[model samples]
Target: MSAYKSADQYRDIAGRLALPSQAFIDGEWSAAAAGKVFENLDPARGTPLGLIASCDGSDVDRAVAAARRVFEAGDWSRAAPEERKAVLLRLADLVSAHAEELAVLESLDSGKTIKDCLNEIGHEVPTFFRWYAELIDKSFGKVAPTAQNIVGMIVREPIGVVGLVLPWNFPLLMAAWKLAPALAAGCSAVLKPAEQTPLSALKLAELAMQAGLPAGVLNVVPGFGETAGQAIGRHMDIDAVSFTGSTEVGAYFLKYASESNLKPVGLEMGGKSPMIVLDDAAIDDTLVSSAISAAFWNGGQNCSANMRQIVHTKVKDAFLDAVVDKAKALVVGDPLDPATDLGSMVSEEHRARVLSYIEIGKAEGASLLAGGGASAGLDGAYVDPTVFDNVDPAMRIAREEIFGPVLGVIGVNSAEEALAIARDSDYGLHATVFTQDLDKAFHLAKRLPCGTVAVNGFSEGNVTTPFGGYKRSGSLSRDNGTEAMDQYLQTKTIWITLK
Candidate 1:
């Protein structure tokens, strides 16, 4: 026997990590009014990981009240940029110091490989904080046109208290995306993590507190969407709300904002992103590699996964053949196994959903090139890496977001047709076009209606680059670069005559 046969045999040192269990309100761990609890499950084996305190609408009210008090206090907001940067810098240091514990907990909660989580997500955490810290001091307002002695100065001020809702797929990374910019911009926040993955966010709150963040500055409440999420959406005291999740949930937040406070809503929603392979594209290893990248990472759960493959008709068959061969080689098994190339879906329900979509594709007469079933001999949730050939642009598989390990191959007669096929989706979150022609690459890159485009390269970016979708895929306020700070800030103008 190779060490422990099952995950149960290996004790998760990460779960026993010391972190506060109470709802972080007013900068401390406080219990909910009802003190109700909910169980967080390990999706890999469908086992209980831990019981987290559940927050209801009433608890959200209290948290919002606390956040508003802190925002109004202006201790952190009105303070100098250097002071804010110092606090955030300290928080980043603490995160780096506890990197291993955080990585282990993330892996345990999300069913991702511990190695991948530690290497990618854990390492990126500190960089994000450090990047935002440097930007804080350099960020300043602009002076607009004014007549004569009348000066029009547009200054960025904290946008009051914000309600940040994070998805389960990449808990800490998404939080870092939202939290770093929001905190650096001097906004107090009430954060609600996905009910399924609350451990990391709870742990994060503890670290933030330890890093000298004052009470009521950052509060994390773990609860269900209907109760806690809806409460945050409609909360009167909340100045804004930033969310990252499915298109349906994102739509609901928008409607709630419209009906309630007419507050600004920042959403990073679903994506049916496309990858275009042009006629001039090299038919070698790079083509195969891009195909694998589109529909494999995180079991293809990424919002920007290269789910839709728009290939030139000249090399369409050849590209599809290469992709099928590469995809079939993927090894699906226990997430802890270092050799496992693919991991489980977030949950059994999500696995079933992915499978159902595959069935729908078959029903619509799309050719199943490879992997249309669950992997055999795996006790945990494991779906085969799927690929559909001869898929029509109009098919549901091509139009909608599967959020699974499925790739849709669409054949186009020309480079124009390829770009057309790629753009013919409601989601413009991300797209990649592969071609050796620099003119064609740059031309398609500008013409494609996505928020971010990659020519020759697949979906990629640093914490400093802006990442969001266009049209229905993302909101105006959630871009990730220097502009990200704008989401948590409101422009203010202060004018005075010479003393």
Candidate 2:
């Protein structure tokens, strides 16, 4: 009760939350053009937390038009770097100021733990704004040496009026991931938060306005993917789009782009990432803990979650025992409780999806090592942290991206075999390798075929490193680091002749 208090307190906030009820367009709170509203449910209790404006294509049109006007007006799209930097920094401070309010809001909205909400909204969200703010002036143009008579310059300019499509898993944090970089690069944006969890994003827009962002510079229209998402993708006025979601939906954006404006589309899609442990690696507490954390963190809803554990034969048995022991001890309870290690699934539909995959794993002949029975009496969308052993690479459980707290263990005879198994995936988003030998670590990392590889532990890198994927997992456009700016910018070369 110390950390997040009782269920009564959570219900108290949930019942009377000052949740936003409208779309943000042209820096004002506006309802959907159709005036439709959707039931925003708290996945923890499967109750209606509130109602949010259910926008559609018409709202997208209004938001996009607003973004276009601001871009053309140069109020934000052409603002000086330091000026943009100052505004973003102020927004970051505001996010920090309203941290607790946002944490509880998101925890209720998404069924994510309040602790996770705090870490994301209070820490990661603001860090992104500050990082991009600091990067604003530091992002330099290039000068190319030419013949003495000529001066050649290369520069990056904002790709006017971009559309940003967000995901539900880490709602506010993902918004910051795209928005901070886009704004820092001096682009006007039309943001669409996932309809299921739009509260924090709406709050963020409010804070941005308070931070002195001009009208029409940042607009957030929350809605279903079919209407608002398609509109943003197919909108003629938008110059580019950045998305984080499934591979299936990611392709639709490309289709929308091809059918309409042929806009540049950037995608950070799904993954069935692997955590590899070689025989030479220590089967100690650290290794065991890393294995569990990689697979179960955030209830394994992460895109880069290392849910596929590919371990060498020699250490497989010991590792499995340690993993099972630790997995059994995880507490699944109220998301608001700070002591809770695992929280509720985002929705009943998603919980069913994860449970279906568990049954599929059994039918496909993998052993249910732990979990998949019943979540300890805490109701709603709660799902147990599940693990499967003897998972073959060909099993559906190993190949598919089960976006839940499901972990599958596959054994290999040698390092080569482990590496081979890890690389065999339609996705190449992230991979982890644990090896005592330095040479072996580098060998696996170089050949993993993923965008980001961790040698000793599980990580997607900090804000400074680029994160995307190889193959179908992502586009050439990355989401973090200086590379994120590339998705929202266009290059220009200027040539001059000396007199």
Candidate 3:
């Protein structure tokens, strides 16, 4: 019924794309220093996509040296803002020109639905480039008022030689979130994409060169976290490191920075975000659909995913019925199929981890309201859209970040109870509330201890709004919007005495 092509058609397109398999450094694709490689598998079918360069600390050092050289040479770092903006705009245009190829590569490499890869990430990636491109020329330094005999000015300057470490969930989009703003701030960068999903990032590096980005201005080294990632975190030459992944890994980055150069580190880490549905929420199909989409979008691999659903007791039965029914109706199949709503996890290991959590939920005594196992007749890393009801706030399934298509529903007696339950988490990344009363909506919005909150909506902040987290969910640095450029820039105050 869907207009999407078959599995064979996707294979043909993927072959035509012929995504690069080597690490992108300086300005060329090259083999690893040790000539080592790692296999990338299609999670949808467990088939080998290709081999990516298995870079290690030596490769990271080379890439960082290249970035530092470019930064010190003042090729990109000293370029005029307007010129940098023009080049970034050109890169955005090229991204649009090769949208389909990038989307296919993302879906194939990350095991996300092709439809989402095309519609969500495909569109968002270029928009981020364009957004930062426009900001580059408009953002300016400030002149501070001073004493009559003195002139003071505050100028924002790019921090040299940034290291960007990306996550696998939204490979290209997350890369854009870091790369766009860093480049706009006139910083040279060495990026490390996740080992599980390296194809799209490599392709992006190639496209950057095509857009006239100078050699070493932007480089990507793909490999395991212990090697390439740790090197970036611990590198003395890198002025700052921007990372997006789990809290455990984020803490490690902090340690790496502390033990090395004490460089600035920005992290957007894990979450167990809550979706609160009040008793007075409009009991409509739209509300049910929005709640479902919030928890399962991108197969719930999002760090801001609303894995916890706290519903008021008055409408608990109705909400649970609708949510469970919708979860059951979701079609889990090959990611290439347009009709499939839920696709496989990023890898077999992740699938097993999610399944183990399901068993843990059962052992911990949460009621299995909907799906609780793998999809029938599929051998890939597919897991059904799972829902667990009668979940306690202290349950492992409710408190932890599943990072999968698993939703836990907890019933609350009042608005006070819902707020208390939502705030009882180490992560303060994202949360949402569904209600008709403006008083209740605004009240919850102000009290919820998260970086982002939506009333009667499901989306996180957009390109115009700042996106990050509170507590352990993120660092002081924020991403997106005009403020994101601040992460890669430092302020210097200059004063001159009048003659």
Which of 2 and 3 is ahead in TM-score? 3
Give lDDT per model, in order.
0.84, 0.91, 0.91
User: What are the clashing pairs of model 2?
Assistant: none
State, as a TM-score between 0 and 1, how close model 1 is to the true structure: 0.94
Give stretches of model 1 more than 4 Å off: 1-12, 15-21, 144-148
Find the 10 residues in a row with the least total lDDT in model 2: 1-10
Q: What is candidate 2's lDDT per residue for 186-281, written digit by digit as tens?
A: 899999999889999999999999999999999999889998899999999999999999999999999999999899999999999999999899
lDDT of 1 by residue, 212-280 (tens): 888888989989899899999998789999999998999999988988999899989989999988888
TM-scores of the models, in the order given: 0.94, 0.97, 0.98
Q: In TM-score terms, which candidate is top?
A: 3
Q: Which has the higher TM-score value, candidate number 1 or candidate number 2?
A: 2
Q: What ranking of all candidate models by TM-score puts the best one first?
A: 3, 2, 1
